[model samples]
Target: MNLTGGIVLYAVLWFLTLFILLPIGLVSQEEAGEVVPGTHAGAPHRADLGRKMLWSTVISAVLWGGCAWLILGGVFTREDVMNWDQLVR
Candidate 1:
């Protein structure tokens, strides 16, 4: 893949990662009943949620980074990259 392709791939991956994570963060807050305004009582759950989010963020980053590297480095051709059929088989 070219530079532009790599940028687009990275952007998409980052967006996907954030998309998956933001909801989890929201749900964690909601579960902890910390979504209400001007409240700070759920510090323990909030911290736990933050840790979960952090781990998820790190895993997503690493996975996507590896995929991007393999794709852009020509380890997999553009046609083969992210091909669900190929992966499923």
Candidate 2:
């Protein structure tokens, strides 16, 4: 792929990743049922869930960036057609 093609692919992948993750990241764990309404902050599970969500968001961002880099670097490519014969030839 050419440089422009790579950049386009990267942008597409980055946007897709952000689109999928932003909603979940924006919501708090308390709202997601990680913590019961009456639960105290001292509860381990409550705190753990919040931490997990944070880490998940960070990891997802890093992964998305890496995928964009790979796409732009031509390390990955999309198939032109889905049919088996088209792919074989």
Candidate 3:
């Protein structure tokens, strides 16, 4: 992938990882019996955004590195995936 493509890929991966990790070990206000006035009970009691971001970055970097290795190393080229039908036939 080109520079822009690589950046876009990493960004997408990072956000996806963040979303997946968002709910893990979460403490909702309702769950903790600490719902504040005018706020939804489902709201997080305390969002550890910094730690989640750090973990997301680390995990995304590893995932991006593996993908980059596969792509840059030509382990699975476009033609390889494109020829799936032919191979099956």
lDDT of each: 0.64, 0.57, 0.95
In candidate 2, which residue ranges exceed 4 Å CA deviation?
1-47, 80-89
Lowest-sum lDDT 10-residue window in model 1:
40-49
Ranking by lDDT: 3, 1, 2
Q: Candidate 1: TM-score?
A: 0.46
Q: Write model 2 residue lDDT over 1-89, tens digit each, in one string.
A: 56785567556655665555445435455455576568653343333444555555566667767766776566665642235467667
TM-score for all predictions? 0.46, 0.36, 0.89
Candidate 2 matches the true fold with a TM-score of: 0.36
- RMSD list, candidates in order: 6.1, 8.3, 1.6
Report the CA-based lDDT of candidate 1 relative to the real structure.
0.64
Two-way lDDT contest, 2 vs 3, winner: 3
| Residue range 1-89, candidate 1, lDDT tens digits | 66886677666766676667654644344566656566645433444445555666677678778987776578888567558588778
| lDDT-superior candidate, 1 or 2 | 1
What residue pairs clash in candidate 1, if any at all? none
